[model samples]
Target: MKDFLPVLKILLRFVIVYIVLVLLYQFYLNEYENDVVDPFTRWVAQQVAFLQSIFGFPTVLVDSLKLHSILFQTEGRFTTRMVEGCNVISVVILFSAFVFAFYKGAKTFLYVLAGLVILHILNVLRIVMLNIIFIKYPQYERVGHDYIFPAIVYGGVVVLWLIWIQFFALKKTDKS
Candidate 1:
């Protein structure tokens, strides 16, 4: 019983933190009416547009109040739309919950903060590249959006988790 308690505690903490963060995110979403786009998603869309522009795509972020979405258009053609999921807050929440679940010390915040910043940057770049994919290769757009790009973002999160585990989170069971 004693041996299993630690695992159970970590699992419990993970679940609790995950739930709380999800609920708080939901609360943030609920504040915006159906006709409005939330600020965070809009900010992400701006970042995507900014990157695309820097890449010489001449991008414009068009937010439709009625539809509550921001469209990424290049060369006066729609390349992609920024929905709530594209904002990367959910990914940040997931990463944070994991870091907190394995709470060791104050460094947990540093790891989570660094992870989130990287994830946000990664997502913006993902959208910019995905926009190019949508523009240049229409057929692969679905594959990139559904599979390839997501792998990149999640792969980054995994790398952060690994770094945390490798340096800051030595397990109690490890003799070394």
Candidate 2:
């Protein structure tokens, strides 16, 4: 029990930081709903528009999902909402905190930071792909959005965690 004190302290710090960050995020989301959400949504929508333009997919912007404008192009409809579902910031922060708590030294820190950046890029690409999928096959949107994209995001996190454990944590244990 005495030997585990350091580990427990690190974990507790991680949890506190995580909670604080999450609360701040929530507060920001609530306080600046339109200012934050709209810009983000617009940016994502614009990116989708650009991608669709390149790919020659038909695209349209409706007031909601109800109205119709055109077809094929990616929709930016849900980009500016309450930041629920597929928000990458939370995941990135959590993964970063986890790595920082468990790992030691600059090399491990750099690797974890790099991994986090890559994960976020992949997540953005995932969003783009999901938008395309939603546009191309409207029927599959539910499955793609709810399940498939989440698996990709969370799975990436899990893989990163495993790598950290295997390379840094477990290796150190084995050496000592």
Candidate 3:
């Protein structure tokens, strides 16, 4: 019983944070009129188009509130609609929950903030890359979007967690 107490505490923290975030997200989604998620989706689409422009791909970002995503059209050829999933909010919540669960100190908060920013940037890059790849090789769209891109972003989060544990979390444990 004693041995499981620490694990239970960590799980309780994680669950509480996760539940709160999920509820907040749900509330945001339920705001159908003058929805907040649309603007975020638009921002992501705009950012993605900007990234595509840097590579000289001639991109267009179409804002469609009804569609609930930003339509990314490149050279009037290939189009990739970036929805809420592409925004990285869910991943942010998951990462935050885990960090809160194993939180050590102010350092941990800083790490979580940095990680969220990095993850958001990576997600944007992933969308841009996927659109480019889809335009160039339409056949590989499913594999790139479904597997390769997620592997990279999620794999990055896993690496960040490992670094936190090794450099920060463990030090606190050792000291205590």
Task: Give the whole-model CA lDDT for all candidates, comma-separated.
Answer: 0.87, 0.64, 0.83
Q: Give the TM-score of candidate 2.
A: 0.71
Question: Model 2, poorest ten-residue lDDT window?
Answer: 64-73
What overall lDDT, based on C-alpha atoms, would model 2 receive against the true structure? 0.64
Measured against the true structure, the TM-scores of the candidates, in listed sequence, are 0.93, 0.71, 0.91
Query: How do the residues 48-145 of candidate 1 rate in per-residue lDDT, one tens digit apiece?
Result: 88888888898988877766788888988998898888888898888888888889888888888889889999998999999999998999999999
Ranking by TM-score: 1, 3, 2
Which residue pairs in model 3 clash with each other?
Answer: none
**Candidates by lDDT, descending order:** 1, 3, 2
lDDT, residue 169, model 2: 59
**Regions more than 4 Å wrong, model 3:** 32-37, 172-176
Q: Who is ahead in TM-score, 2 or 3?
A: 3
- The sequence of per-residue lDDT tens digits that candidate 2 reaches over residues 40-102 is 444445555566566765455333332211122334443212233344777877887787777
How many clashes in each structure? 0, 4, 0
lDDT (0-100) at residue 30 of candidate 1?
91
Comparing 2 and 3 on lDDT, the stronger one? 3
Model 1 CA deviation exceeding 4 Å by range: 171-176
**Which candidate would rank higher by lDDT, 1 or 3?**
1
